[model samples]
Target: MAIDVRIPTILRSYTGGSKAVSGTGDTLADLLTNLDGAHPGLRGRLVTPEGGLHRFVNIYVNDEDVRFLGSLEAKLNDGDTVTILPAVAGGALGFAAAHALRG
Candidate 1:
């Protein structure tokens, strides 16, 4: 399946400053892996070394938080929109850190 992933402004640098990117996969994990393949260091920001989602990040599928649903195993249909959100502490500082680290 092909899905649209909305890259938050804080993490756009990893996608070469793209706000949205399209990837093909059946599950969220696969989609993320594909994205990381295209944008180095992206997977590390979203998922931990233990293969779990990072605590500071939340992934939404079609406006529904995937954590409340199935996490990275969430099923993705064609055209689904996945939004990557990184929790912010101090607005600017958090965003800047996300950009620098993920970029």
Candidate 2:
């Protein structure tokens, strides 16, 4: 299946500064493999040596968190959108401060 994978700002270097890339795979794992073939070293940042997603990384398929849909095993289809984002942790006051800055 042809999939559109969205790359976050921090990882754009691997994609030659492109924010999104196209890859082919039947599952999320295959997608990453194919992606790495074209964008070498990209997978290492997303998957760990243990063959699992990095703890601080979050992956979504078509707007749904893949963790709820079998993680890397999540099935894929043509035209599906895959988003990879870094997870952030902060206390309520920290969040308020960040949000206040946006005002």
Listed in order, each prediction's TM-score against the native is 0.82, 0.85
Which residue runs does candidate 2 get wrong by more than 4 Å?
90-103
TM-score of model 1 (CA atoms): 0.82
Q: Compared with the true structure, what per-residue lDDT tens digits does model 1 show for residues 14-36? A: 99999999998899999988888
Superposition error at 23 for model 2 (Å): 0.5
Alpha-carbon lDDT, every model? 0.88, 0.93
In model 1, the worst 10-residue window by lDDT is 87-96
Q: Which candidate is the best by TM-score?
A: 2
Q: lDDT tens string, model 2, 1-103? A: 6899999999999999999999999999999999999999999999999999886799999989999989899999999999999897767577667778988
- For residue 37, what is the lDDT in candidate 2? 97
